[model samples]
Target: MQASDRYRLSASATWVASVQMEPAIGAVAANLARSIELVEMAAAQGAQLVVLPELANTGYMFESREEAYALAEPVPEGRSSQAWIALAQRLGIYLVAGISERAGGRLYNSALVTGPDGYLGTYRKLHLWGDENLYFEAGDLGLQVFDTELGRIGVAICYDGWFPEVYRRLALRGADIVAVPTNWVPMPGQTRDGAVIAHALTMGGAHSNGLTVVCADRIGTERGQTFVGRSVIVNSQGWTAAGPASVDQEEVLLAPIDVKATRRARQLNDFNHLLRDRRPDIYDEQSGATAGLRQR
Candidate 1:
């Protein structure tokens, strides 16, 4: 409320939501129906940006690569993608959802982004986890930061959040918010404080990068694998803006995010800035990541 703090914001705040739901295996029709319903609910509650869980269409746990291909569809033009685009246009809001994308005779775990203007772009998941390697190709699309009326938005999938580099790279590319569509499972070795492994990852990613992180995770067991369902939204200060919802329920976490303040939070105190303080002059990725970005 102080006049000096006005520099933390450049425009109005945006109301966003993380829609947590359970999608069934290969049940494209049913999953699409349910996801549409939940997005509508979030919009009804005044969400300008709504994010859905990973594999929001065909679900996780494919029986085979053949099954995965059978359930996957093309990007933007796919029936599922078209439906979601229409929903975003109708609601006059931005929507991000996970989909099983079939492209170039290969299958990818992808997220489709849409807005009131229509289809925006697709982000193929960079890090494939567990059985994902067996069925889906590791994401080919590099870090993509989408500029929208609300702000600069970015997308990441489940396993991608595990790497600090992913968040760091997105922040470096000028992203204000990172929408994570995840299907989280339990991490081995419980902590003394009993914090959720996912909480540590998302909150840390947000605080270190000064980005708002909105995660929508799925629940339920399919083919003997259970998903941990504590969906959450983390603010730039590494604090909970909304949830870490129930471990067994379907829920929608809605919150108002001050994106400009988040971007400004990168400046800690009067002397240090998170991004500017990086010692990239002496340190290097050594993993060839910079070369890849340059090629792109």
Candidate 2:
């Protein structure tokens, strides 16, 4: 190996992985075991950061609020979270996974972040989608970004991708990579032959924010609900670095990202910068113009 090539690789590369798996409804134990196996596999392939789909421990569909509450667990202290933290520490990798969180009498859709040291923090889903509103409260923790040896990491869950403000806020806070743990379902007008809208949304968010977006999605049908499995890793240029994995398969997508380089790429040209050129003041002032439309 050439010394120059080794030096370049060490300075510029960070490997990441996205795990797409199918979780049986209410099967917490089995799901956590599978997740650990997949993370180990990703680490074997040299992934420094590993991401898993939303609610990866407890499957997405719940028959009733009672069932959801029964499945929800405390963050970091939950058995599933502790297992993941131990795995991350043992493998010297970073892990971000979604879990149903129970706090007092309320349940929240949350994502847990852990690294080689231990639990970092959690990001509750800020936006609830469809039936999720029936079971979980909307997030109150706000947007969270964690600083680590790898880089600045941000987290978002499922439907949060539909809101542009989510990515903008993270970018404004200097996030280099955003790990999205999603459970994408077929939206209205979705067809088997068409491009998945979720994928398009993630790509747009990544390019606009100059953030590398890593999405880990679930597959398979649970109860009567079907999840669209198109887990993907998009580079800062809005290009697919790894997947959009099989629509109904369990797979791991691996990619190498240079977060520092992507952060620098935010400057589109000598005369333009993506975030700096934002006219936030004008938007805030004219926000009234859209108030009527919003009311409708």
What C-alpha lDDT do the candidate models reach, one value each? 0.91, 0.92
Q: Would you estimate the TM-scores of all the predictions?
A: 0.91, 0.93
- Going through the candidates in the order shown, the clash numbers are 0, 0
lDDT of 2: 0.92
Worst 10 residues of 1 by lDDT: 1-10
Residues 125-230 of candidate 2 have per-residue lDDT tens digits of 9999988999999999999899999899999999999999999999999899999999999999997547899889999999999999999999999989888898
Give per-residue CA lDDT, model 1, range 1-296, as digits (tens): 33124324423768889999999998899999999999998888778899999999999999899999999999999999999999999999999999999996899999999999999999999999998999999999898999999899999999999999999999999999999999988778754235688889999999999999999999999899888888999998889999878878889898788877887899998999989998774456665447657777
Clashing pairs for model 1 are none
Task: For model 2, give the 10-residue run with minimal summed lDDT.
Answer: 1-10
> Where does candidate 1 stray beyond 4 Å?
1-11, 190-194, 286-296
> Could you tell me the lDDT of residue 166 within candidate 2?
96
TM-score: model 1 vs. ground truth: 0.91
